[model samples]
Target chain A: MSTITLIGAGQMASALTFPLYENGHEVRLVGSPLDDQVIDRLREDNYHVNLLRTLHDGIHYYKESEKEAAIQGADLIVCGVSSFGVDWFADKILPILDESVPVISVTKGMLDYEDGTMQTYPEYWMSKLPEGSKQEIYAIGGPCTARDLADHDPSFVGYCGPKMETLHWIRSLFATDYYVISLTLDVVGLECAVALKNGYALGTALAIGMAEKAGDDGINHNNSEAALFQESVKEMLDLLKIVGGGVDNIMYAAGDLNVTVAAGRSRTVGLLLGKGLSIDEVMEQLKGQTLEAVVIATRTARAVKALAKAGKVKESDFPLLMHVNALLNEGATLNIPWTDFQKEM
Target chain B: MSTITLIGAGQMASALTFPLYENGHEVRLVGSPLDDQVIDRLREDNYHVNLLRTLHDGIHYYKESEKEAAIQGADLIVCGVSSFGVDWFADKILPILDESVPVISVTKGMLDYEDGTMQTYPEYWMSKLPEGSKQEIYAIGGPCTARDLADHDPSFVGYCGPKMETLHWIRSLFATDYYVISLTLDVVGLECAVALKNGYALGTALAIGMAEKAGDDGINHNNSEAALFQESVKEMLDLLKIVGGGVDNIMYAAGDLNVTVAAGRSRTVGLLLGKGLSIDEVMEQLKGQTLEAVVIATRTARAVKALAKAGKVKESDFPLLMHVNALLNEGATLNIPWTDFQKEM
Candidate 1:
């Protein structure tokens, strides 16, 4: 059993310690500078602050200052930072890394350009690394929730990177029966699919909000919800194809979208909006929350709007994303465009 | 306003009368030979037994003996029968239809031959029509539930047929602010996509059962359910391709699959089976209930097995369907083959 070092003490990072610990690996979890409190809590009583679970005391915990020590002699490193921490990790941690030891990221994000081109996290980091560096970065996708993984629930995910051999080796080391893995070489597809799901998840969950706004509690409004879901997936498919992704990558988008719409923080954001709450009201209510879904929604809209202006794509192609952007940024009311959804062929 | 006659009084058939009446058409509801009780109840109290809601009184109700009187329509006809009533309608109702009027089916079904080739109901009905006589058969698809439609909830459906003008004409007469319609010429794609949802809905619902069986009440098991849903969609994509259907036709399958997994009777079957109940126990418990899911599951399984023998498709391509088939017919328990779902690419 080789050592595995995780560079962020976030929920996903801490939760992942279970499978690694179960696999007889010497796992080291090092917190970023902002995660000092969580690191302290974890060190004090084997309790994770965000995951809210009592983890095995055997895991080695380290603060930001101890990151170098934690990274020493690691066979595999996990880039477990959130999108907000990407630049932080790149500036502070990438300079100290061994280029030969491969890293797989749990972070799901993308850099969207106005030209209808998007870059996955792996691409972003690979560009930032020293030129001709041998480091490899992979991205994870599909409907994996931190709590579910910690609970040992069966979860499916796509492990995507450039090298098939590296992906197979990572799958061999990381995958449990519960943490089932599907490998793909199309890292951009998996990353974009997962990132797109966050915002569209918020959009799809508007059905609950729509129902609540109408004061109809008994009906699930599944007909409308399913319609929104299909439209979200259709937009995701279109966006993925535009970004040079694969068709089979739809599984990553559709599955995770369902999970997020069902129980993620994205659903709560959508529920509040569906109740006719404005952007200011929602921001005040959910203050101190990350609100990545909102961030991604507005970001994607900006990119799509730019793409539309450049004649790369049509604005009508993303009614759901545009609507969500309006809801989150422009204080627009929650009125779904039912007519825009019905396709003609 | 034109007079439109519907040839069955099932929940789906009866539920569709709301849109027809709201569109200012004179709608006539006719019972098949077996729907005498429903017809009598509708005639006596203006109530539908299955839809469980009061409908508009303007709709004319007719018994099986009064079919020809009801069919004295001017513009169009709705073959609003369930799959079970398809043969009955073809044998009894088709003989008297005026060749000039177009017939749209709310019934979702298909005939699967042992040769891995499937015939959609529209194709089935057209072939059975007398030689040299013309009857244009169309189909409706998507995530439309009877209760939601009868409640005048916002719904989106695809109106599919051979002719664009005819589909457009029917859309003008049927679509409302709430009852939205999408028009497509891929009758086979839409039909197969919808018919495939029933059995897969059963497979997707196994997550709820597995969670219940494990006594894990706190978790929604969205991961497993979403995985099952995706697997169901993937298998559907493979089968739809094999059957000469279109790729964009997945919206019909995925959306309806979500609806069925959410509230349809298929969920109950999956739940019972997931809780480790045998098919005999489930049958005894749900006796007298018309389980079209069971029928379709076994039917598709037989056809697929034959197709596999002929080297048309691999059984591994449909682990979800094959597992459901075994659970229903082969006395197998509810252990899902998680390994089988992982894709290597």
Candidate 2:
């Protein structure tokens, strides 16, 4: 068995350690600087507070202080950090000398510029390296939730790397019957497709909150959710087209959007918004919680604004995203512009 | 005000009377020959037992005996019959002297042949008419549910016909602030796209049933649902492509499938299956309840088998549909063939 170094102890990273461990791989789950408490819990009783489950017993936990020792790994490295920990990983982990190992990340966010351009995390990380550096980071995106993955519920994900071998190697390393991996070379498309799912998922969850606020009694407002979900996918396909992703990738985006809308931290945020809680109130309430939808919505709106200023894209192109951006940023009310979401389809 | 004749007095037909009354149209809700009891309730208490709501006072209710009067001076005719009543409609209602009236149908099903061919209900109806019959039946499909429509939830639907005038006329008669109508000219594509939703919707609801059987405690298994949703769409697109439907129509299919999965009669049946109830058990449980998903799943399997016999399409192209068919028709177990669903993305 090869050594697989997982560089974060967060929910997704921790959950993924199961499949890797199940495949008999030596998984070194190195906690980030912020994960000291989690690392202590793991080392103490193998319990993950956030996941609310005991992890595999064979997993070797490492504190952030053991970076150099963890960095001298042999076979593969998985960047398990959240989008927030990316910079820390870059500053501390990237400076190590083992440059020949293959790296794949579970992070699902993008980097945008004021000039209205977007890059996947891998692209952004690759740009940070020396011009001739051969280090390539693979991309992963799909509907696999951490709890369900740990539960061994059937999950499908996509992995895109520099080559087919990179993908197949990853499949061989971590693929299980339940954790299905689909490989493609269009990393940017997969990244863009999945990143867009978060904001739109928040958009779809608006209905559940609205229903709760109205005191639903054994009935639902799923027609509204279905329309919103459809709008979300249409807008997501728009971004996928813009980012050079294929139409085939919409399945992945659909899967991600479906799960995010169904349950998760993002669903909670979306439900609160729909329940008429103001952005400030939600922010105050969910302090320190990782609101990826909020981050993505605000950033995507910023990028769209810059692009619209340059006449590269129109503001009305993403009415749902624009409306969510308004809710989270401009202090707009919970009124959705349903009429604006139509264009003859 | 133009006269709008809605035949069959069913849930959808009854629901549409609200919009027509809102628009000040003279609505004639004619109960089909089978709807005598419903008409009796409507006349007695102004209540529809099925919709469980009192309809508007403005709608002129017509019994089956008044069929001749209802057809005399209608500006439009809406074929509100289910797929089962299509033949009765053709035999009894198509003979009326209403040659110039525009017709639209809220029915979302198709007619397939043993020769591996499929025709939409409208096309099948047209085939039986006189060779030079100029009457064109417009198509409607989207995520609309009867209760949601009665609640005036924001619903988006596509109206595709032989001409734009037919769609616009229907839109004029029905469009409201909450009921959004998207117009297109791809009638065949819209029909094929929508007809495929019921069966796939059943496929997506398997996870919900499976969860119920496992006695989930404050937990979800949406990852499975999301994967099934993705698979359902992929297979729906396959049917759309085969039936000359465009991929652009997938949002309608997605919207329809999403609603069916979340909450509905079909979702109930799927849940029973997932909860370890056999097909016979589900059949006995919901004695008179409408099982559209079951009907569609069985018919789709029949057509697929015929097609496969002629080498028109492979049965594996629709693993989910075929599996559901086996469960409902062949007494197969509830085990979903998840591994048979993989192909390169």
Candidate 3:
């Protein structure tokens, strides 16, 4: 059995242990400083309060202080920290670790540099690592929710990176009958697709919410939702192509976007916006919740807008993105410009 | 105002009048022989029983006997008949149609011939037209439900054909502030995509039904549904490429598929099946309702299987289509082989 060191004790980190344990891998789940209380609880009872499930006996829990021990002699390391924590882990943790160990990231997002360059989570993490560290980094993406993963419900995820061997090893280590993995070489495209999905889902959720608010409760707004999805994807493809990513990478990523729009937290936020809640009101209502779409909308819009100003990207190519950016940052109303939507790119 | 003649007094045909009337087009709505009773009701009162909407005063309703009068002096003709009726309309009605006049079809389906050739409705109609008839034919497709269209809920449709002038004319005649029309040169792809959506929706419905049956009540299977959608679109793109259609035609078509899979009757049928009902039981349960997916699944399976045998198409490339066919035709259980699913084309 391979020793898998998972850095993060959040829902995803906890849930991922199920598949590792099922595959007979020795799991060392190390919590971050924020997860100290949760780690104490897990150590006390082996039950994850957030996931509402008990970890398998083969999985071991580790506190923040046990970081070095958790990584010692580990065959593989997976970072399941939130996108915000990736930089910290790369800077503080990578310097102390052996450079030869492979790393897989479950964190999904894009980082906007002050210089207007956008880097995917894996890219940012790699750049932050010690020069010449050469750690093979793969990103796990798609609509695999923590709750569903914990339930062992059928899930599919894309394993994407430059190193095919590392991807294959990571796939073998985590894939279960219910947890299927597909590999892709388009890391930039896959990461961009997953990160942008949150913003798009928010847009679709707004449609559903608007329909409901319009008192068309019994009406199926699938057409409108589908139209928005189509537009979102079109914009995504254009943006991906401009960002030097493969358009075909969207085929793998489209399903995840659909899932998120249909029923993810991003859509939940959009639903509230559609129900006549302003962005500020919605944010107030969702107080203390980590709205990933909000962050993505703000950062991606800023990054893309900067790119557009540099003539590297065309802003008109992505109306939905601009609208979302405006809604989040400029206090723009949630009234989507349906007529302004292009039928084809 | 252009005089527009619509041959088919079904819900779609009736709903379409709202836009034409709103555009100030004179509408002559003629029912098929099967819809004689519906015509009688429509004549008795302006309210269309199926669409649950009152016909605009400008729309002139006609019986099957009045088809010639309906078409007389028409600027444009639209066939809104079911796929089965396309042949009959082409054989019986086209001979009477002015060869110079243009035609548009709102009907979405494919016809399977005994010789194993599958032709979309527009293709079948085009083939039936006289040699050198050169009557410009356009197809209207997307996630447009008759109910939503009648409600004027900001809808978009793909107007596709080889003739740009005819397509532009039709778009202008049908375009309203809330009713958007986009043009495409990909008649084959759009028709095939729209026709095949019912089958894909059924497949997705089965997933949703299976999830509901699995006792995960609050969880959204959007991921699984999205996965199925991705597979469906991949198969569609492969099939479209084989059938001389643009793969990018999928961008225009994906929304319709999403809408259909999200809320179409095909998905409704799949839901019943997912609830542990046999095909026969589900058929019995949905008696008096038109199951488009059921028909598409059987005929498409037959046609695709024949193509596979002739080395024109690969059957293994389309596992979901094959599984759906077996479940419907071979009395096979509704067990989806998720592991056998291809991640990408």
Q: Which model scores highest in lDDT?
A: 1
Question: Runs in model 3 with CA error above 4 Å?
Answer: A113-117, A216-218, B112-118, B216-222, B310-313, B342-345
Tell me the TM-score of each prediction against the true structure.
Answer: 0.97, 0.95, 0.94
User: What are the lDDT figures for the candidates, one per model?
Assistant: 0.85, 0.84, 0.79
DockQ, structure candidate 1: 0.67
Worst 10 residues of 1 chain B by lDDT: B216-225
Tell me the deviation in Å of residue B123 in model 1: 1.6
Candidate 1, pairs of clashing residues: none
By descending TM-score, how would the candidates be arranged? Answer: 1, 2, 3
Query: Higher-DockQ candidate among 2 and 3?
Result: 2
Off by over 4 Å in 2: A95-99, A217-219, B217-219, B306-314
lDDT of 1: 0.85
Q: In order, what fnat does every candidate score?
A: 0.58, 0.55, 0.33
Q: What is the DockQ of each candidate?
A: 0.67, 0.61, 0.46
State in Å the error of residue A77, model 2. 1.6
lDDT for each residue of candidate 1 in A1-345, tens digit (9 for 90 to 100): 979999999989888899889888899999998999999989899999898787887999999999999999999999999889999888998889999998899998777776656778789899999889999887788888888888888888889988999888888778788888889999888889899999999988888788878784555587888877777877888888888888678777888887898887888898888788887898899998888798778778888888899898989878889999998888788888878776686
Q: After superposition, how far is residue A153 of candidate 2 from its true place, in Å?
A: 2.1
Number of the top candidate by DockQ?
1
Model 1 residue runs over 4 Å out of place are A216-220
